[model samples]
Target: MEAKLWFILLCSVVALLLYVIGFWRRKAGEAAFAAARAAATAEDRDRYCRLAVMAGHREACKMFCLARSDFFEDHRPLEPFKSHGIKVVFYGYYYPSRYTDLLNEEQRAFCRSLYQFKEGENHGIGFFKACMSALKLDDAPYHIMFMPCSDEFKYARRFKRLDWYIRTHRKGRTSGLYDVDVFEPRDSLHEAKGGENRILERNYRITGDIKGKQVIIVDDVLTSGQSMADYKEEIERCGGKVVAAIFYGKTVSVPPMLLVKAVVWGGYIKTG
Candidate 1:
């Protein structure tokens, strides 16, 4: 009986030791992650603010201030506007939300470890760096216009976010100016299926005048060209031309013809 009791006690002690080790490791890992995230957030703020100061963009300075303070608090997933702006200047494409999914496990792990967004945010500082590293800012266009996002939220907050990022970062070197008021989506047909029928119902009307302006349409995803095409037609009707369309992801679940005219993350890949 004493021998059996000793064996049981030994087993219990081993199990307890294992549990303590695991608990310690978990806490250590969490602490490391938190520290890394804090560092990244600080770095992003400095980089963005420095760029804004160099460019002499008034609106960007305002955004930098907002980002620093806790005044504006929305938890929804935010898009990486810096990458979108930078990509538009060079390759006309930005990193997609799922772009990391395509990378090898090690590369993906590195990305996840390095970049972290605040609660309810999607991509983080790492995504912005990836996009910014693609090209030099001097090559960006003088006159850049942002297209409205989908019609779901009624306020077009995402579209406004993108517009804010571009206006602040691009810094318009030439005398030519940047305009954010052009297109506004009157309906939310993005989630609907089928082709031009849904696009017809989308009703993305021109709220502000785009007459005689060369527009650059930016969106999170480009599935069918219908919405963009519609925007182009309306802009043209008002004597404005659709100079280029920029998107983070071009979904490949659609027909092949649609991808031909669009520019998305890495250009050609199945996003479905």
Candidate 2:
């Protein structure tokens, strides 16, 4: 039909436009990165940072926004959650390449100061509290669980304690309104396979029973949604209804070459 043909043509044109814009943005980003590297001085680097944004380098813009603690507040997690029977939310984005990995000592110090991690700070609890308040679940009793991370990640260990803190500290004085428990998996996927499917095998076995329980999954980041998808499938299998999921950040893909060069350049600039 003529309508089908028109639809296809429209989609093709839109795809082509997106491709052209992406190519232009990447080229501009590269030029800006090169200029920033050559500039060496703080004032010169700052000037190049503005140029990168003006040139439409999204990554550069992310870095500038991150440094100022203003990450464009336009991330959407709802679309990814539509397929699965779950709701997910994220507070902010963790940059693909941290400034410390791409800048000199002075720059690194400045960047560190911008995003400082104080001792005894648990971002998960903070986000959880905010989520509870926003959802107006002050009087509702619920259970919390964690999507297991690699053993090497500090977040994994921190959650073990944070889980306890939430159950004990976040509880209400009223008996029915404050009951909380944190679930853990005996095993978890350590890594993801490469290529199209990016298939991940479920290595987790829930340590506790959650028959007819309302559960929420807390994670540090949501990458491909594969891990969480697997988590939801397994949790539902155990009769636990997943109401929502919360994450500290969402993962954004970055060019592998840029990441490698950032580390190399950071080391070289530091020594010089």
Number of the predicted model whose TM-score against the real structure is largest? 2
lDDT of 1 by residue, 1-272 (tens): 99999999999999999899877755554444334324445555434443433233333333333333222222112222333122232211222234443223433453343222211133322333333344333445434444444443432434444344555654542111233332445544444544326636433445555566555555444544566666666667866765555554333321132221132212223442
lDDT of 2: 0.55
Model 2 alpha-carbon miss at residue 198, Å: 2.7
Expressed as tens digits, the lDDT of each residue in 130-236 for candidate 2 is 55554433455567877654332443454655566676786641111122222333233322333214566444466576778777776665666677778787778
User: What would you estimate as the lDDT of candidate 1?
Assistant: 0.41
Model 2: weakest 10-residue lDDT segment is 173-182
Error of 1 at 203 (Å): 2.9
Question: Which candidate leads in lDDT?
Answer: 2
What does the lDDT read for residue 73 in candidate 1?
A: 22
TM-scores of the candidates are 0.39, 0.54
Consecutive 10-residue window with the lowest summed lDDT within model 1: 69-78
**Per-candidate count of clashing residue pairs (backbone under 3 Å):** 0, 0
